[model samples]
Target chain A: MIKNPFLRTFSLGVKSLLLHKLRSGLTTLGMLFGVASVVAMLAIGEGASKEAQDQIKQLGSNNIILRSVKPLEESNSNQSTRVSVYGLTDGDFARIVDTYPWAEDVVPVRILQQEVRFGERSLNPRVLATTAKYQSVTGRPMLEGRFLTESDEETVSNVCVLDYEIARYLFPFRSPINERIKIGADYFLVVGVMLPRVPIGEANQAAPGEEVTGEVILPASTGRKWFGDMQVKIRAGSRDMEQVDLHEIIVGVDSSENVPAAAAAAREMLDRTHRERDYEIVVPLELLLREQATKRIFKIVLASIAGISLLVGGIGIMNVMLATVTERTREIGVRRALGAKKRHIVMQFLVETIVLSVGGGVLGIALGLTIPEVVAAYTDMQPVVTPAAPILAFAISVGTGLLFGMYPAWRAANMDPVEALRHE
Target chain B: MAEEKSKAMNVSLEATAKAAADTRAVAEFRNVSRIYRMGDNEVHALDDVSCRFNAGDYWAIMGSSGSGKSTMLNLLGCIDRPTNGEYYVSGTAVSTLNDDDLSELRGRHIGFIFQSFNLIPQLNVLENILVPRFYLEDPGIGLVERARDIAERVGLGSRTDHRPRELSGGQQQRVAIARALINDPSLLLADEATGNLDTQTTEEILELFDELHSDGMTILLVTHEEEVGKRAEQVMRLKDGAIESVAYNRPTIQR
Candidate 1:
């Protein structure tokens, strides 16, 4: 009877929703929670992934690390097998710096596990011997005293930097800076302490015969003079053991763009220099990329799981709407008898569903916004909330409502007036 | 009294005598038959029925439960179509009209009152009376004022705002009557308008129908009761979907 069919149908929809407030509310709850969970899960996953990526990126995406790998034959050989030798030396680092134009900075490291004693305080720790340039290359910041200087390396000074955890463990009562510590009868002064860094692999554990309590950093020149190609002893049996000479080196490139080329260049040079393949180059940047790819896939899977709930919510809406159609059969008959057209009936139901879904969507958005904060407070997992997430969630919810509402609305519109009137 | 009686007899004879007079017909049925098919069976609701009624006339169709009285009322109300043959209202062949045209014709020319006083339960008495006006193109009459006028004329002025559920059987039927007359249609079709009411309520409805006929409104009333049929100016009895008898009443002169 009315010319403005949209407005009329919309008003009728509002009235219908009002008629069954509880049913509408319950139906809306399903959609609300569905959308909220989808947004919240994605936000949390994104936050964790972003934090990891930032840490990796801070590790300098351009850096390439090379570590020694002892051959299986060397391990199985007799204890008297004259100290098996492997991995990069001063020659490999010199060659990469000289040959590759892309090589901007190079920092080589040698590691030794030794028992250090200061009075009754005796502890074994991972002692890294590296150049002063290592500090700038790895972006490692010093918390106290000073980092290794070029003068210290030149003079072969016995200056050392302690990891924060090691300093606290070694000198619990006093700051370890400027304190003298002994490493296998050699005295070294602790110059500075480094802040804590996230452990690379599994939770902090030591390699065999390696110390776990603290880390000791020293100049590479001083390390070469004292340890002089330190040997690692591996025992196969009670009496059968072998000593191996190997070194772990981390080479920093100019930028992330040059990392792949640097790695390739280093691999080519190493392949030619070593008669036997006894070295492995580990690229933390490549691992970081792989991890990022995995996280992206993880996010998609998490989002899909959350999307299932939204689908369920839509089905819930359809179910309730169908029930409503049956419940209001008499009302539809009355309206039809009063001159309402088929389209009017269809629009009335459609608008009712839209109102329910939109109301739920708005509430879901509010709920989704608080999810990050809620997760941070109640759980160890961090949640990241982005504007796009909630917006997409709302859109998805509304779309779901519209898609699911059609069948029931069509059923209502096509109802026979005579049969509907006689429906009990 | 004698003069009045003689004048009434003269008027009655003149009306019967002038049945074949050349006047424009308001409703006509020519060999109209209605057959209802139920599965493999067929039942003739109205068989080869032919009838005509002039403008400004009051007629009653009387019959038993299965006598097709209600079918005739439905046909006159345009709520149904004849199975075969032609039925005309206001000189328009109704059987040939499409659904839209039929509905328009019903809105403009025919109004109906049902046996059960079929008022929408949620609507007020006034709203019930204005239901037909919703279908009108212009509604010609101011809905509120017309509703109020009809309510008052039917002795329901005080109850215009009351819902159908709140009204008594006779009050509801009166509202239905008011609704049927709201459009000022050419023909008023009532199907047992007072069927659900008590004797007093039936008398009130019949008195209202009498007043409506006196006001020059043509009326077709379907009823099973002889008393109800006898009250109208003409009576046609239907039996087994065929006309059984026709009778004319004694009409009173205007003066």
Candidate 2:
């Protein structure tokens, strides 16, 4: 078939639109926001999920988390005043090292809530007694100085890494590096300050709670010397002594596939060592799987909301086109008298609507792309622009035009030529 | 080969043509009847009206209100159909043609001129003349030059680019005439071509029509004015949807 005179028709469509610029522009605005919202919302969803994935990925797939739980065996003996301590012991730790040859690093941590003092400022913060491997495992970036090394642990150096919040409070006017904070009797040198983690998921979306925010880091050797693990006192109304060897343990295996086996093996070893249930194991990889499944639903809901706006935009196009058809009845009559067929009439109107929708789509893509950068700069949220988003939005806008333009074009095409000529 | 076949066909049609042997009518109506319904009342717009328009003949239809002259003009233009009876244009039965075929017939063979000089306000004079030809596939060779020639022929030589709103009443009518003649149609139907014009402008328009008629163009005009009727070689008067008389004026002006 001969190619229809599309360029001529298109130019004519442009001419007609130029005749009523204000009306056409107002109609275009509806489609613009519709497409823009689609792109922007999708980008935000992608960015949020990307951050969540990155946070989950930081905890290596092969890594296992085991936390200490005080057993209830001695809880009723002293009720409010008596201290009870039952958790991961040295025997369990030793047995795990002997059993799992594939387990590379067995990081031990002993945590105690203590008041840290610096000159005029004193704040209660959790003091974490852990190895330098904590930075490698958690993937938290340092803001100043350096983290504890093997040498620091071997020499039992009294150096600590201060979380940025505590550092800011303790040394308001100066860098916390090389500054000493007095914990109990000894003053420990601050080696580094950690950049705050961009806490992912529920933590960021929740209400205020007494969740752990700021903490001081110490080499395991220094913690053992300063804060003894075997001896601890609880002061409620009367003082009582409790014996706790370790608070938590992080075990890393060679590969993700070996995690289950290593975790089960470690569990067996811990079971033989402890007569009471005093430890819980968590797999970051398994938690990541569950989070991924939930995020799919979140993405769909966001996309649907944006899609609804686009649908509304299409309706706006239909409204404008119907008015235009009514206004151009005389023109249609003239065209028919000049030998235009119904197909020709349909093509003419389709060209006009396609021009409107496609114009709006291009504008919307530009707006959508810019919004992400604007949001990222002005707010804490990051938006990711995927390649498919703009293309998909553009396609939908054109489709919307074709879909909505059908009725108006049909109405124009079917009008009686004589009656149309008689129209004012 | 196709042209030879069509030429032979035309000769045979001329011999068997429904009108008189000597005068070959370009458009012929055979007992045509057109009735309109006005709320259960059947109004006979054209009650069994019969007419023939020969090639190269100039004629005028004169009628008063409710005389069915408008319906006759519409039938000539091929924009409307007769409810009953046969109408032929260029040897083809118009009643048998579909909407698209009718449009093509009008575009290729017939030209219509409205009283109001309904030139689209947006298009300039040259573009207005080109509107009819835009419907044709090839629009023939020298399309632009032909349009220019028609514009110049109608005394719109230098103002081809001027829009309808900018032109005077006479000038706009000239543009409409140029548009009607751009297709070089065989039959021209002018309905009150000089209705909205001054006496002087009407005379000028009538002279132009006379000039076209002398150039072998078949012209049919619908009007109520005796002056317009006098300009034609034949005049058909209609009263109440039927022909009253066919009068031939004495010696139509040579100019």
By TM-score, who's the top model here? 2
iRMS per model in Å: 4.6, 3.6
Score residue A230 of candidate 2 by CA lDDT: 54
Q: Which stretches of candidate 1 lie over 4 Å from their true place?
A: A1-58, A73-84, A114-126, A132-136, A139-219, A222-228, A231-248, A251-265, A275-277, A296-304, A355-380, A383-387, B1-255
lDDT of each: 0.77, 0.82
- Residue range A1-424, candidate 1, lDDT tens digits: 2334466456556656876788889999999999888888889888889767766765667788777776667345554535555667678877777777876677888878677777787777788888888777777778899989999999999999988767766787899888899987699999999864444332234454555455688998998788777455545553322233336666778778888888888888889998877788877789798889989898889888888989899999999999989988876754454444566567778888988888888898889879888878876666778789988987897798789989998999778655565576
Report the lDDT tens digits of candidate 1 across residue range B1-255.
432443354345444434543366788876677888899998999998999887778899998988888677767766567776566787676645655566668767777776777776645787677766765555554568878998999889778888788888998888888887887888888878777888898999999988988888888988888888888999999999999998888683252
Candidate 2 CAPRI-style tier = acceptable
The best candidate by DockQ is 2
- Residues A1-424 of candidate 2 have per-residue lDDT tens digits of 1124787678778878888999899889899999999899889988888787767676666688787887666434755555567888777667767777778878788887667899987877888999988887666789999999999999999999998777877887999888888987888999999965454344344243434357899998998898886545557676565667778888878778888788787777777777788888877787788778878988889888988898999999999999999999988877776667778789999989999998998999889999998988887777889999999999999999999999999999999877887788
TM-score of chain A considered alone, across all candidate predictions: 0.79, 0.77
Candidate 2 to truth, TM: 0.75
Model 1 interface Cα RMSD in Å: 4.6
